[model samples]
Target chain A: MSQGSTRKTLASIAHGRSGDKGNHANVAILGYSQDAFDWLIGFLSKEKVEDYFKPLGVTQVERYLAPNVRGLNFVLKDVLAGGSSASLRSDSQGKTLAAALLLMPLPPDCPARLFFKG
Target chain B: MDKVRIGNACGFWGDDPQAPAHLATGGNLDFLTLEYLAELTMSILAHQKAKNPQAGYAGDFITVLQSLILSLKAQPRLKMVTNAGGMNPLACAKKAKEVLDQAGIVRRIGYLTGDDLLDRLPDFIRQGIALENLDDGRPLEPFLSRVVSANAYLGSEGIVQLLEQGAEIVITGRVADACLTVGPAAWHFQTPLEDWNTLAGFSVAGHLIECGAQVTGGNFTRWQEVPRYESVGYPIAEISSDGSFLLTKPQGTGGLVNFETVAEQLLYEVGDPSAYLTPDVSADFTSVEIQDIGSDRVQVGKAKGRPKPPLLKVSLAYRDGFMASGTLVAGGGKAREKAECCGQIIREKLRQANALPQEFLVEILGAGDSLPGIYQRNDPPEAVLRLAARDPSKGIIERFTREFAPLVTSGPQGITGYTSGRPQVREVFRYWPTTIPRDLVPFQLGFL
Candidate 1:
């Protein structure tokens, strides 16, 4: 909430994909560079992601780090109603979950200058 | 570096049919892998087999083979591996043999069976294998009557055996998708079964290319950077003996094979980067390194592996229910409001008729409600209203399908885009992921 600070979405600094594991969905968010990855590690906490996808009725959320690829994978449990054959949702397999998560607003005080167009 | 090239052309059953011939002709490779089965594909094949004795395999593969007959004849050294034998490997192999004969190309065709455990369910139960669902830990007894297909994901051992026996084409049923690549890599390098590190590396390579064009720019996050999607080249892994490989695509073809593209694919459907479970080895994807070496080329190496699990994951699908989805595009000023109103009308009508389904969902496509939480838009010009439902009774789903058509005339004025007719009702094959003792399900290898 600082003046003169720019606000940006996570999609501007990262890219990701999501897939289903039964009723659970895993979203892998990858940063464009090592610096962006470090920034993500410090900012994108489990509670933050849980709150972001709270509307989907996610029972639990666990984060895993892959430093080699500068990526963080968050598994959202019970997000899919019943998965493949059972789910009635338009994005049943959570294919659009990653894109939706990428729309998360970054903190105003974050290093916006470090980000580059991907 | 003693290396062998393996290219995966067909990712799933409905991938481009011309991909196999294109890869076989252009990619100077040792093996061409085609993965036809998805998680629920076996249930469909099982349903087909129950209807006809001679059915239940990926018939599209045979058609692809027919188209690739000239390429098969031209590239005699190029071998093929596939799990196109959805529920029936023998039948698929027989059809493939006939196709080969018609082209006068004499090549040994081998197949791996014993993955299908539907017939052996009673035996497994007698042996005290509970086959509980991996997700919910629910007992399999309640769903036994409706079980359609149950197949354990086999490893590369059978595929290696077939290749060692001079089988030019090896077909299998329900082998791990990665085994299609690992089998050839292990056979070519003569790696031991317990060589976990090398096997793990091969597993990672296999996983990358298992989805065919996925590793080579298809479904990439950075879609704009990808060169050509119309003629996207399938992925080819040039793997070395020491568990290293270069992920690349055929030259002069569309699509990219950069560091970002390969990295994105490495995490596709992946659970833990440290423990990517496969039948061969638990590949540690985090240890692997990827670097963009050149145009459409990525150097990927340092993939470590752990010991194979004592049990093999089984993909069991049973008849759960019937589902139907219908979509209607709403336009004009109050599109979002009209779409929600339309959904409520249908729900109320269904409630009044006592035909309410087990689960009903009304989604507004343009309202950013697809993911539900993040991107809610205000007052969209138009929106596609998608109404979907599932029920145990087929009659209920059939009834639900008819409700969409009536909405065109009876519903809100803004409602449109209903020319596609009533939504077709489809039988739901719910997936049941479980594990079986490795010894209980043995790989059966045979030649046609």
Candidate 2:
């Protein structure tokens, strides 16, 4: 549908638990260590959170910014568990998903702290 | 004879993807060249060797080869030459063949190597050849133990040899960029190796196409006026057997080709322009000609040459240990003042921890040191503070990282930009370049 809906869908797929209400599963809270939070959300920020997750089926990712602490909530669609089945990950020439990812500039500014507490 | 038209697609591994296809079809070219090696890239590849022995060399070349495979198959007359082989041409060739085999193309591919000097360093040093730094002129002894890789920039002759050997595709490692285009022209024209003028002209042609679309319009200062930027075109070198060539690009592709575009590409790799030295000859880039051929086409040719300098250039990468940088901003009218105070505070904290390097640097961007005389502002409201240092000593850099947060409260203008904790130390790989006689170094060519 819209960009927002896609992000929410992708987030669900990445951290969702089994047996969700619909195709969108619950976004799992993958632990909340300050270090882990900083790294995960910080990686998102460093890599341009919205752009990075957009292709991964994360259409609408709501990120809450704070001083040294923040959180990003997204809706993920059918963007996980397929591995070799992702279209955005590979564009027809066997170039790895990592290679495609490298071409996109990381957000010029990285989050100072963990944007995601959970 | 028909003019030898050589077009280029990707300048380096990270270069734009659509370049080769656009230039090949657009320029109506006979040959295509892709140049993809820089001094810094060589160092990065050397660093990769520490983890994976076969990891050195740019793999993007293979990707580009794959991208153009279908196009080449459709156009049998289109021969491609590239130095994407990096430090390992034979290995690169085999990988390329793997891709070709998948495409059902059983063409004879030629690979040229011998650019690296891994086995001959000790002998060269023993022969009294002090491979001094071209920039600082320091002898390369201190870095002997940490030296990881060393390669000389070969010229067009080696590539010419491969082309003459009936190679449908020629791959090389660390050859001068200009040599990529020059070699094919020299081979096709059968230009005598000693014909300095023609060689220099071909050298100029090579230099023009060396950066791919840079000569066409990518990154040109006049980029604003370039048409259709969504699909920017790459450069094409139309060469004649007599040493004259034109610099241009595909029709209808985004990017401009003019004297200014050619001039900017010429400005790259600064040396005395009158005597831009290479292994084959010292080129006189000053005598070159650039004329607009048509829409998206510029004719460039008529260059001069001199004898090659006696010493060959070498690139050496050694383990210089690790480094890391952390930054914070202190705002307000006292921005400059606050930045200074932060530096002092970091020094104090690191010193008390007994973790300061023997030599370290603390810089204040927007401060006089960062811009030096570039920006003339009347006491800017904010300043970006930076600190850098290195040491042969252990834990010094990590110790320096721990000192930043204290400055958040201690510094004059408070703090900003520090979201993550103190930074980590990263090992630094340094570069060294030296020269040796062409006769001294030897190479072996075999399939992997």
Candidate 3:
């Protein structure tokens, strides 16, 4: 915790979308601004995302940098059971995976908070 | 530079049926594309075909084309392309031709076939072609008897061929969804079939608007920015000869076309951004530049392309097992606890009956357990407890469906919401994605 700093959820700084590829699901988190994108590049690592979605029994989490869209895409493997057809989960395609990731708490001193107002 | 504007109104079979007429009449376009088939849609159509010989295609296209007859007549130059032919292109084309004839419009209806591989599976096997799964390298032998539908994704060459041969309306089966756009763009610009860069650019544009409203702010994350949902206009790609294009919706129509909306769609259902593989060309989406040129208009250009893959991807669906799910509402006090308790009761009863399924899941909808541990929160006033299971045996799935009703009277005090009766057991159509050498499957084109 830093002096005069506040903590917030990742949703405050970024928005995302997710879809399925067979049993795997890919979630793309796009930062609201260039500063937020830079901040996300440092804070949102693959291990952190994997840990966040650990309850989903993700086999592997691979992250790809998309500076073009100012986004980071995380491909969570074996997370959708058997995906669209065979998966029994209500969120079979992992449509809400991005919304779940957005719930991750941001650090107290995260600089991206400047874009948002309380 | 001369440009051809192509608008896609229907993304899939069940998409807004009125959109094709809306886009055709509104956007002064050169071509209109309607994509219908998804991965599992073919299997469904296969089942339909098995019941009736001439009933394997997307029937929605005929209804939509009938509505678009006046619009098509109004814009004489407006051509249309679609893959509404799921397992049967000839039947789809025949129905479409009847619609045009009834409307007193004389237009050539061209169709492309040979993508359906169900009949040719044994031939491929005899030729030493192993139709192994792309995800897991298991050969498609053990599940051969259970296989329903198999179709190879064809490319834009046949589409372009049809367009060049003066086919005003092109209907196809199992062609790459993007090829619906690529075919028209390539034919319009007279681009060589091997011009990977141009072909890739068209492919990217096709991919962007193929889902209709997706590129036009349908599922946008910043949904507030999109105005007028009552009639969100479909997407239009105003493409030029050099492979650059501007994406926009119809004038005065609701929905927005911006960098964010376009970018979001670019990532939709795509695995690797750098290399988006297709039958026509390998598109390098990483190099693609999206610029918001104006309100409801975004310019997308500079998408690099590589040589097309030697293999064509095939979508194979088989009867894996049976699945059934039922949901009940749990409320009053600790709703989460009650929901879990109800789930347990169902599982226990199923176990006692010796009807344990291969896969089972219990989801507490409103309790933040939809993604399980990701959204942990305290119990709310009410929550939906959904119980789902899958098994190789239909008897087990049918047994699982019957367990939900008993929870209302016997299990938790809060359990109620079972008005829909027992959930019906559905046959699980498992998907198998694989690739085959391009030369193996032949492409056929015809007119109706």
DockQ-based class of model 2 = incorrect
Off by over 4 Å in 1: A1-6
Ranking by TM-score: 1, 3, 2
Point to the candidate with the largest DockQ.
1
Model 3 fnat value:
0.57
RMSD of each: 2.0, 19.9, 2.4
Give each model's whole-structure lDDT.
Answer: 0.89, 0.63, 0.88
TM-scores for candidates 1 onward, in order:
0.97, 0.71, 0.95
Query: iRMS of candidate 1, one decimal?
Result: 2.7
**Local accuracy of candidate 1 as per-residue lDDT tens digits, A1-118:** 1231355778778888888877888999999888899999989998899988888899899999999999999989888988865788988889888877777778777687657664
lDDT of 2 by residue, A1-118 (tens): 2123213222211121111111121122221234544554545442353455344443443333221111232333333311111111111112122212222332324333422222
Task: Compute the TM-score of each model's chain A versus the native chain A and list the values.
Answer: 0.91, 0.28, 0.88
Candidate 3 error regions (>4 Å)? A1-6, A113-118
For model 3, how does the per-residue alpha-carbon lDDT over B1-448 read when each residue is reduced to its tens digit? Answer: 6999999999988999999999988999999999998887899999999999999999999899888988887888889999998899999999898888889999999999989899889878878888999877999888888999999999999999998999999999999999999999999999998888888899999999998898888878778777998799999999988788999988989998887888888888777788889998998888898899888889989888999999999999999999988899998879999998988887888788888898999989998867777666557889999988999999999888878888789987888899998898988899998999999888999997
Pick the winner on lDDT between candidates 1 and 3. 1
Model 1 preserves the real interface contacts to a fraction of 0.67
For residues B1-448, write the lDDT of model 1, one tens digit per residue.
5899999999988999999988888899889999998887899999999999889999999999998888887888989999999899999999999999888999999999989999898778777888999877898977898999999999999999999998999999999999999999999999998998898889989989999998888878878888889999999999998778999989999998998888888888888889999988989999998889988999989888899999999999889889999999999868889999999998999999999998999889888768666666557899999999999999999999888878778988978999989899999998888999898888888998
